[model samples]
Target chain A: MIDAARERIIDCDWHYQDSFKEVAAYMPEPWRTKYKHSNWDDAGVKQNLSSFFPTSTGDRQNYGKVVREHSNYPDEPEEPERVREGMDFLDIDVSLQISHLILAMGGVNADDKRVQAFTKGYVEYMLEEVLDPDDGVYGLAPMPYSDVEASLDILDRIEDEEAYVGACFVTAGASPPLGSRKYDPIYERCEDLDLPVVYHTGGSGLDEYVRAGYQEMIETHTLGFLESNMSQIVSVACQGIPEKYPDLDIVFMESGVTYIPGLISRLDEEYLKRPEEAPLLDTRPSEYITDFYFGTQPLEISARNELLELCFDMIGTDRLLYASDYPHWDFDSPSIINDLPMLDDDDRRAILAGNAEGVFGL
Target chain B: MSDGLVEVGPATEFEDGDHAIVEVGRAEVGVVRADGEFYALRNQCPHDGGPVCKGIVQRELLGEFTGTGERVEQYYGEECIISCPWHGWSFELETGTHIGDERIQLPMYDVVVEDGIVYVDTGE
Candidate 1:
């Protein structure tokens, strides 16, 4: 059933993390010595594996057992071969991949030469080696929010690359909000380049706003994405970023679609009360919201129909994009979305392909 | 006021201070009474699908027309407004309009009282 839409499918919200060794190479000298040496390595990898899955490692060959039983490669893949395997598993046609830290979840720092070096290196490597080689893969370039000028400089260089589709910004705990004057340069760059800004769920530097002792990674990951995206939508709408840059697009990656209806209505309400503030916009917040897109995975079945209807009602069919979040814990099977109850053929087609084509200019 | 009558509930069932969650066909409708008139609307709140009937009723300050006749500071009190339990998206029961945003309107169901019993048209 998905065969027809297979070529059209564009998974807009997958993630890729560099190997610890690869990531550590760009870390500053002292952090390299302290964090990398203590937390990761050949031996540390083995120890971590054993601790995570003690019972499964008892009788089998050490290296083979560790790789087979406890490896998160199935959970998180960095290698191209593993990524292909993940795509095959989820039946996804294409993936737009972004990194958690490389994209500034910790906040972009221009003075931090280490971050600049690491991000540039990662972006170049991913584009040239990983995504460019495969027709089915795309890359979202990293943005350094700490220094918008430098980030725009990098964007100007990467804008023409076929593998590069957009820029990924860390939404969780972003200082000065996404719509502030501080980000005008970045927004201006995106507007000029026609690159959508992508926001992913988790990484470093959000510990301040997040509560302490929140042990479950799932809760933290979910809350972080939802809260961050919600605030981003509000800030952008209230501050008239969408109005300022009418052609610029934003993609809320990893955040589920459940919260969207409320956010849209809330923004609409706020706009009504403060029309003088957004004199540039000709329509309500919901009208501008339709210009943006969202990627959904681990598909929310319970309220899928209602959410889809509401989003479609406000944003139209061109805004919803399909994604699989390949190799993640709650990874969605391609067929799972096909099995959702009561969706019509046209809506399904939009969710799978047509919307994505419009989003990525494919 | 118009002849848009449908059997909603017993008049006593929806008191001045309370609301009734009525199922008319597949649609869940919220029935609330304020200012001596009963109002009915689709039960689902625009924000996150919170149950509107379960939300607290409150009065809020809305912008009012100014003294200069320019409609500035348009502040008005909407009594018996239902605030969604999830994210607080409020709607005035009398108009089915979102409290602050006048553009988005909740689907309203017609209601009438007959022999001390009230009826609401589900519009399904």
Candidate 2:
């Protein structure tokens, strides 16, 4: 049904659950022993999902009704074989399997050698467990931005592999955001490999602003992404990352598309007054945004037409890529844009597949 | 027959590029004249109940190009575009079709001119 209607459906945002146990298997001698006994949630560990109010969105009418289906545990991730069945059912041409917690906590929080251990383990396991078995599946190599050199080594190995589309640089549970000078080597390596650097953030990593102690999971889930993507995108513009690496194509995921234009507007206002702050930016901060792509899930369909207009006027037709957060409770359907009256044939085609092809160089 | 027709009086009432509300039964239809043609669409904008008939009439913006080291704004054909003042969603006066989205066509009434009088089929 999905394939017949659209030219090519490239799902930009999808998830894979790689447990610590899975990565530990690939760890070398001494680290393997430490991984077996280590607690992921130890105090000051700065790991696992950071949250305060679990029931944050207690104000919504359907707040209590947020129930996730499970075959085993409540959030039991479907095995790769079962996921293959689901993908075939959807007929999704490209599913970019993004990791949420694996690199965000495991590699970023781990020390130097452990960073190598976690990242390399992630690539090996994802290749064997997720992408290799299915033609429809594509992988995003999760590199620990904490250790740029090690990440470069891993990117060299997997970047040429046909199954791997790009690399993910998650902001959660990390230092200095995505576009920091520390991560420049990693960005340069990704650019050299001709792969897009995907900024996929999750969990409440910024605990300072979050009402942590008493807030519910709902709070972290709902309010967590407030500064998640904007802060990182600003980092890119303010630090002149786009000017630094014009060839680099960045894809910001899990954030809605409408706010980008508005964010750019605010950033441009600052740029006008503080032009000296970012001498590398040749145009408005938002103009630099046009060089990037965005994933659309959790799309607010209440006023879908206006949303599309905002995208067209600010982001352009090719900037918004269709994303289905598959297997998650709130996964957007592939046909989410099918009924959008604002979208012409060209707009629909680009969002569905063409845009992704350009970014991922598919 | 006067059945669904609203007597908009003489065609002279609406000159080229002019628009007015014609009340047929209880429904109000917006009557616009452009390029020697008359268009009748529901006065209310389907999107936000704004006065669609009273919106600004303009040409369709096809695109722009400045690659040759200079700015050039371009347009093709005369699509009598009326933009909703509230949200700025433009609609084509002739077909009552939205400029961007094809699915959200506005309610259009059939307009006929007999002799010199303008009659709108409000179809109430």
Candidate 3:
């Protein structure tokens, strides 16, 4: 029952998250044991629930309105049928999956094997329930960054899967930068397999954002995702991810598009001042962003048309992919794209589908 | 005005895939030996004024991309490429042209070999 939504729109970012129990079914041994004891509703795993959150941001009256409108959001983020209804409402065609509860749930604490278990569990369930069942569904397998061998094992299994769009990670908490030699094997595998590496913020189970001087949930929520994307973008570009693995394409998800122009601009400046620090780079810092794609969700909208267009120009329309961070509190709708009066027909088409078609080989 | 000759080194000094920077008149030229031939280019990168001479040299890569629902890999030739150390702007060492943009190129210098020596005509 899709509304009169465009059939061509690919929701570049969406979630089909399953709980620990769902994941544990396919998980092996100790991790299966761990899931039995895991309590997702514990204060530790709670998202966007703070005693002072509603009090702090009440002036922003439209706050949480969209999530409120859709009763299924956040709670049923992983429910495929429920998700399909939202997609139909928005008229979204393909919705790419990037989950948080599996590999990253352990964050920096889980040892390698545990992380791998969580990942395997999540992907196995996804295969059984969502991706295998839905034609328009594509997913990025969650990677356990704690162990190289574990990550490789998952990739080996999924190498032939058409539903496997790629692999997803936030930045590893204390691991080497994404461009480090430690990750070369993974990049090499991705290169041969023809899957792009996808990174999104607020994963890794860390939720380390509360340490960033923002006490209220809104403040942490607002800047947390942005910081994760920003740091990795710098880490990879400056450290030579593109040069090292020329064939591997990377996509940054859910962080709004505004941060890209500034980060790349700063990187270009920093490279000019201290070229020795980043000897791996073969081109200007800005050029690496050309090899990458940015997801547009919680897409930026302001009265400032020129600045928004400036971002579109800076990254090129071909490099930006439309995303709806769907089923989350701040999910952007496919309908809002019609509101982007700054873009032309060609640019809109590219952002909506063409860019993704090229990026994911959709 | 003839910039005369900048003696890069003995031909043996640069094996295949070897590169060295030599002083040429008012500028420094990077001379690379690839596939039994010596090639030289100005050290200055046109993009962001990077030191193009002090970069990595490797075979031109034929990489993976979306085409016909599958990934493809095939190199154009055995062309050697030099990538700027600051950021990864790759230029074909033989032509000084960036792999993506033909117009964005490093200034090419002439390399001539006589006997067992490699010389760059830096055209001062």
| Candidate 3 wrong stretches, greater than 4 Å | A1-7, A37-71, A102-106, A172-174, A203-213, B1-124
Instruction: State the lDDT at A131 in candidate 2.
Output: 82
Worst 10 residues of 2 chain A by lDDT: A65-74
lDDT of each: 0.64, 0.70, 0.71
Cα lDDT of model 1 by residue, B58-102, tens digit: 566566656785745735575657666433567777788887788
What is the interface root-mean-square deviation of candidate 3? 20.0
Q: What is the lDDT of residue A186 in candidate 2?
A: 86
As a TM-score, model 2 comes out at 0.66
Clashing pairs in 3: A107-A204, A281-B87, A281-B88, A282-B87, A282-B88, A282-B89, A283-B87, A283-B88, A283-B89
Chain A vs native chain A, TM-score per candidate: 0.80, 0.85, 0.87
Candidate 1, chain A: TM-score against the reference: 0.80
Error of 3 at A319 (Å): 0.5
Point out the higher-scoring one by lDDT: 1 or 2.
2
Candidate 1 vs. true structure, TM-score: 0.62
lDDT per residue for candidate 1 within A59-93, as digits (tens), equals: 21222211211124423436665566666555567
**Candidate with maximal TM-score:** 3
Query: Which lDDT tens digits does candidate 2 get at residues A94-118?
Result: 7888764453452244334876776
Tens digit per residue, CA lDDT, model 3, B45-91: 66434467667677776766668867466555677787764335679
